[model samples]
Target chain A: MAEISFPLPDLGEGLIEATVLEWLVTEGEMVERNHPLVEVETTKSAVELPSPQAGKVVRTYGEPGETIKVGDPLIVFEVPDDTAGIVGTVPKEEAPKRRVRLSANLDED
Target chain B: MSEHTTLSDLEAAQDNTTAADVQQESVQNFPEPADAGATETMSMQQALNRALAEVMTENPRALILGEDVGQLGGVFRITDGLQKKFGEARVFDTPLAESGILGMSVGLAMAGYHPIPEVQFDGFAYPAVNQIICQVGRMNYRSRGTLPMPITLRVPSFGGIRAPEHHGESLEAMFAHVPGLKVVSPSGPNEAYHLLKYAAARQDPVIFMEPKSRYWQKGPVNAGADAAGYSPNGSRVVREGKHLTLVAWGAMVARCLQVAELAAEDGIEIEVLDLRWLKPIDAEGLAASVAKTRRAVVVHEAPRTSGLGAEVASTITERCFGTLKAPVERVTGFDVPYPSGDLEDEYIPNIDRILYGIQRVLEYRRG
Candidate 1:
């Protein structure tokens, strides 16, 4: 599995760094691309940086209240098949169950 | 050590010694970048980019926010490759509104982060004048020193390459007039690199004006200066002389050097002082030089009447009145709106006009 390390981006122009407000998911959690991974505060606005890839969270850098510069590695994601372009996440399957149909209700009455 | 090529051809136009001036020895000692290690012969645009990148690399609190600073890498490409290197969260773009860019910067500074917002162009900065002139300049005072706003406003200014109406201008005097703001305009790539780093790491708001004319001018700069070499508060003497003092900022500084080459042929040693820091100008340095020369000439791309040149001339007059030989002169743009590209060369102070101003000052006699 390839570990994709995503760096913090310039949330806005002239902004070089941001303070980590919170991490949305714990390490080892499965995440999809565009998922809100972390909330960072730069200037007066607080924004969540979306995950750039769908993968199992390998590790996260910095803690709450910690400041991180743009380009500093923030989160690492482990992917089974490391795709070059953006890869979407598919959630795990739920338990299988039977369904009942009510299409003949009027004829039976 | 001077690599600058003076306009020797200009001497042919007027019967002055422009050729001899350009041939003078030891004009200046532009520091070698390798003295510190890992230097690049980058242009002003690239130098500024490296400074922004280095500052961002060192300080987690420094962030860049502006229009097209991200993805597009800024209009001048100064901020190009920064967004990708820093991340969109830290090097992101903003709306086209000028006020919005600066307004957010003020808020960001108050939130305990240092912000460097790019105003894009000289003309585009007008919309953000309110935030820059009123709030950004007075925030520390308004909060009674409780709030410290360390915002560096990056504005590309000056004329010569025939840019559109608003893009070509030198509004340093307007911003320098605002109290609590440090106005700085770098003449070349080195100052652009060092000054931007100094401005970004300071505790006050700085109007960091980049000379558009010299954006492509290449020079060697200590790629990384441990943020220790220069402070964004003083001037630099680009060339040393004794006959008279030539005070200029931004693009005009380089032009003054060319003007000096012409004046040298006439046996007039012109001292070229680059007011890198416009506001809180190096009055002491300027006074000392003007005192020795007993003559002065101020140059800028702004309209005359009440531009930066006037301010410099007045200050020198006030400080060096006892050692005065003649009235301080000013060579500047006409007191009207800038004309189109075809007429810009004439409207802005070229080397010819500057040479004329220097000659006029040299002829000054206390009658």
Candidate 2:
């Protein structure tokens, strides 16, 4: 049994949350990667949230009228057992850099 | 007989000393500054221009950029004669793009320069929203301790100027939504002077909004050695009273003060609070005042729906709920699209409107 948890993606620069306008898929449905999963309404305009992984939907965390945070899991996916091992592992070209700095100048104050 | 007379005299002397000490203590506790009745008059626009000049002279690296800022000195002449005085190098004009102005300011700061870019009007600042929200607001964090963008963007905002659409808009909430930026607006000439100096001195990006309609309005400004008016972060109690508290900023603050004066004539004492720093508001001062008064009326020229007044009202309700005598009232613009310039007087909150809000708050009964 492989489980996939998809977090909310970045909508825009200053947008923190969006209103869930409508859901495109139902429970227990299969969804492919990059497919439009939900339509979210922001202060500026309405935007579509895309699926991050290809799998069968196991659970949905929020209702249509609810708002979710940036890192909150929107959906849980059950993928093939064989592909489960590849989900958590980083690709050779995309591995984290050793010298990358994450400290922010804003923290000085 | 001689010993009895001396004892009575000593008791009387002791009582006199105690009474004198009590009087001295009270006077010392509330020492008043010598009131120098001196008045100076200058338009709000002229005051802002003077503030920019003072800051520019104090700091060589401080630069000003905006459409018409260089040659034209702004549509209202707020920056008039600045380019000639400071030279084009320090106060030059920029291309007609707000995003470019904000983005370039971020880059300039990364290269060690303080850029004070002006958005020609409140409505025109929307084009630069992308850069402000993404790059400028988060550059300090994205650069990972490598950069500090100390930029100040001046936006002339609010209605009642009889200008066209896009000219009179209160978009402070949009900028306030960004986490990394500081938003501030000055209500008078005195604040115009000190707040600009404070913005220039600080090492953070600041969006300073100036009320265009109050440009010609005059008030007393300290002409002493310390030119910059007063403390930037602290809230000023323009009018003191014990009844209700009226909170306002920018141009609306003047209207609040006026209402306080008018209310005084009707035997109602009202306290007016000027929130100099919109973000990181002086919550302590406001809450304390509201707790004392037990009634609050928040005022602003922005639309009432989801405006800055809502945030202020919520915070006050949360902090002073136990002491509040009535529900918080707000005097603001209607929730419709900003009306034409001719009808702005009816749309924006005026002195009479604020007085009405105060009366409503005072008349409410708490269960």
Q: Which lDDT tens digits does candidate 2 get at residues A1-109? A: 3355667766887777777888887879999988888898767789887887788888877777788877677777776533412212211212211221112121211
Which portions of model 2 miss their true places by more than 4 Å?
A: A1-109, B1-40, B227-229
* Candidate 2 CAPRI level: incorrect
Model 2 lDDT per residue over B225-317, tens place? 644323456576777787889999988887777677667667677888887777766777788788877789999889898898988899899
Model 2 pairs whose backbones collide: B44-B215, B194-B229
Q: Looking at model 1 chain B, which ten-residue stretch has the lowest summed lDDT?
A: B17-26
The candidates' DockQ values read: 0.01, 0.01
Question: Model 1 residue A25 lDDT?
Answer: 89
Best by TM-score: 1
What TM-score does candidate 2 reach? Answer: 0.68
List native contact recovery per candidate, as a fraction of 1.
0.00, 0.00
lDDT of 1 by residue, B1-367 (tens): 1231112322222232122222111112232223445456777877888889988877666788998787656766677677667676677889999999999999877766678999878889999999998889998878766666789999878776666678677788899889878788888887899888877877778899988767766676665544354444567777889888899988788777876766666566789988887887777878878887787988888998778887788889899998877798988899888876668878987777777777676655556
Q: Note the B-chain TM-score for every model.
A: 0.88, 0.87
Tens digit of lDDT per residue, candidate 1, span A1-109? 4345678888898799999999998998999979889999998699988887688998999999999999888988776421321211111222322121111111211
C-alpha lDDT of all candidate models, in order: 0.75, 0.73
